[model samples]
Target: MTRSDLNNWLIDLSEINSIYIFSGSEGLWFLISVVAFVWFILAIYRVEKNDHTSIEEELSNPEDLKNLIIEINSDEVDKNNSN
Candidate 1:
């Protein structure tokens, strides 16, 4: 958006007197919260991506996959019983 349009949107979204969002020094808190949320999502995505990549790499060995499946099932059963 143009500078004016961006400014108007920000004003509406984070107005000093608006009841929807905090104002004053809380502006810094709002910015930090947004950054933290984005970081958390990216971290989760990276972890899941790595897990899938590792599993695909390991799947190259058929015997290894069979063993891995047995291990995963055994762990699940153990966890269920423990809980």
Candidate 2:
């Protein structure tokens, strides 16, 4: 479609100020989009919160770091022995 047709379509959409004006499929899709957006935002928030808590716990316990380093070194040694 031409730019004018696209512009007119956008203008028409802008005139629709309420969800009730949408047809069945349009309303369903709009609701689905809103729900998906909220879910995405919540998921991101939860991930960030979990990461901060995990970091704080790791910092509070030095032994975890040492254990992690030991595991890494052991894995490297096993790889070297295999090679």
Compared with the true structure, what per-residue lDDT tens digits does model 2 show for residues 1-83?
Answer: 33222324336676655444333457689899999999999999999999999887876778887888899999999999999
Once superposed on the true structure, which residue ranges of model 2 sit more than 4 Å away at CA? 1-24, 61-83
lDDT of 2: 0.75
Model 1 stretches with alpha carbons more than 4 Å out = 1-23, 70-83
Give the number of the best model, judged by lDDT: 1
TM per candidate: 0.47, 0.43
What tens-digit string does per-residue lDDT give for candidate 1 at 15-75?
4343443334567888999999999999999999999999799798999899999999999
Instruction: Provide the overall lDDT of each model, using Cα atoms, as 2-decimal numbers.
Output: 0.77, 0.75
Best by TM-score: 1
Give me candidate 1's TM-score against the actual structure: 0.47
RMSD of 1: 11.0
Candidate 1 lDDT (Cα, whole model)? 0.77
- Name the lDDT value of residue 41 in candidate 1: 100
